[model samples]
Target: MNDISMRVRPGTATALIGRNGSGKSTLLSILAGLVRLSSGVLTTGRPGLTTGYAPEAFPALKLTAEDYLRGMGRIAGLCEAAGRSRVSELLATFGLDSFRSRKLAGFSKGMLQKVNLIQSLLIRPQLLLLDEPMSGLDLPAQHTLLDLLQELKREGTALVFSVHEPQIIEAMADDLYVLQEGQMLRTIHGAENLRSAPAVYIVYTELHPVAQQAVKAVPGVRTMQPAPDLSGISCTGLTVDQKMSDTCLQQILAAGGSIVSVKPLGGLGDLTEWMDPKDQIGSGRG
Candidate 1:
């Protein structure tokens, strides 16, 4: 499972996706040099291209979170003063400033996770390796980390991580690589927004008679029909994407429509199946 090879360019966020036991963690550990690679070459830009790794398991330690982060920065060649400054900055960034001096042994799972992420990010490493940094964080904390990673990418960092959530992958990744059964099945490069091409869907619902006309008036909806019960209606429309689907549905409900269900009209096998190529408008799905 670990004999795979690939390349990632700077300034892109690539998602490493796979089910458990598919070697995602092992691959990350090998990349960080924490585990020995049995064969094949693994290379990177010259030394001083700082690299930081946050393992999936937050290793237990006796030291305070602040100390651990400062130590990592120092080892990465930051002077004592600079290391301390960097650690302080990251502690605040992850909202862990209050717990900075607390011992790791006393920290909650989420608190320790905040420390793990901060330690890796404090140095502003050129190559950032995060193994599920958002694992134990709350929703708001997840957003914070995601925003930070996007900002870091703008500064020329190469970010890569493994995640199980499709929604996060949809929101954050510029490239999605699917790993299955010890092999990389596909590599998809492009933003999720780009994938939100104009696509058609078949929507069915039971709406108030007045609401039926309102749903037909919904901008993206192309057509509608009454079912035999006359209490329900069907809508066919060009939608922006999955995200917008919810908003359009909400509009129907707000207008007094009771939605029965929504199902995409295409299969997921084709790269462009979910998106309507006509609405792509050069934003690109590469």
Candidate 2:
């Protein structure tokens, strides 16, 4: 974790991406105050800031899911009534209401993971840290959790989670920090724009109407629209199938359009290459 500097803004989701043993868990622990930083400053927007942390694994306890959550809520300083209400609400929200009285020892991996997430979300902390949040779940359950997290983010909770799945990163993360051997390798902003498309490239340039039409006429161009504030035109195209990027570039250049920047949107392949070469692209865990 040396020379690491990053910010998790309110209402934004930040993702920690890395291979196994890359200190993702350690960094989350530090942020959650479960582990202390050996050096460097950690500043929060306010004192006594509430933070929730959900680790990758949940212990199998003999207690019922509801009872366990109630105990945790009490430990978090919620009153008995509040604890009961929140526990019930979260259990039902995660589609575990019917199994609230079931012992955690008998629960399946996906059910336990739901309990793990519910516990961290009990107090509705300003900042929530989750490690491998989507480790064990079906597609529907995953979508349910994502929707809940998005609702929390809308209410101004800062989310920081370690993840490997490219779909999760595209669906939730506003910014992504890639870690390798405990070092910050890259910080990618606007991570939400990443799509599952084969390959999408964003081109920034100032172009007249004629040039815009010319660029749009390129075989692979998907869209050509004016940039926000009308500074220039932004062109998006698909590039992987026939390697049409070169042709697109040539078209823009031939139209006398000055290129500002051209970059490909991060996709499954890009994320896999960024995290680790040996691992599969959508394994859903780090």
Candidate 3:
């Protein structure tokens, strides 16, 4: 992403958001120094910066979760005893204690995801970079990870995560950068003022005739549009009044359709406001 310039301050969380192939990953890799820029200056300390990265895909390895994390801690320059202690803490904190000796190959996607997250935290990074950090986790795992992130933020660790999860951004980020074609199209700040999108849910079930008819009767709900990835029948992407979300869920269950995703697209109201040219961030829209 060329011509993109932004600053992530200490003790703040920044979210880099954009559609697929909009250069979010590349930009993130560059910032993490995994990829080098052809030109332009990246100011850093003479000794180089430290970071923690959790990519979307877990690494291919046969090591057990505990062993792998301990190895990572040592690689991060921690002493053997310290590394082991840290590994124990991280594993227990993420609820991988029972699976401590289990090899990663035998682990489920969510379990592997937990390990992936653990390795990144081996170092108390000054800046943490997480790419789609919630991709392969269930609700409980996601909550655990987010809670850890919140704890880190309180300790003054700077965070920059690339995510499609608007909820994560609204709850954790101090600023959000919208990337388009490798450049930042807009920047939205003010976490306190940013309104979380009110409870948007995406239901994914085979549409039955009875269910379809019954869903239309749900107050404040319109027909769900197919999402871009064809991942599910999205009941989200539109405004959903918070009070009616529970009733809508009940109606979907009654209709015999199973749920695929119940996403809380927070910060959506902020996005809508940003979409308006009159909004402060909208003034810089491309």
| lDDT tens digits, residue span 177-277, model 3 | 88765788878787864554355656556566676666656776644655443444434222355567778777777766666666655446535432222
lDDT of each: 0.70, 0.80, 0.74
Which sections of candidate 1 miss by over 4 Å? Answer: 45-47, 192-194, 197-286
Candidate 2 per-residue lDDT, tens place, 146-254, comes to 9989999999999999987878888888888888767888787875344445455645555667766676777766666555432434543323322576777777678
lDDT of 3 at 74: 84
Tens digits of per-residue lDDT, candidate 1, 261-284, equal 565532122333222213223221
Q: Order candidates by lDDT, high to low.
A: 2, 3, 1
Deviation (Å) of 203 in candidate 2:
13
User: Between candidates 1 and 3, which one is better according to TM-score?
Assistant: 3
The top-ranked prediction according to TM-score is: 2
**Alpha carbon lDDT at 199, candidate 3:** 55
The global Cα lDDT (0 to 1) of model 1 is 0.70
Rank all candidate structures by their TM-score, best first, as comma-separated numbers: 2, 3, 1
What C-alpha lDDT, on a 0 to 100 scale, does residue 81 get in candidate 1?
95
Please name the candidate that would achieve the greatest lDDT relative to the true structure: 2
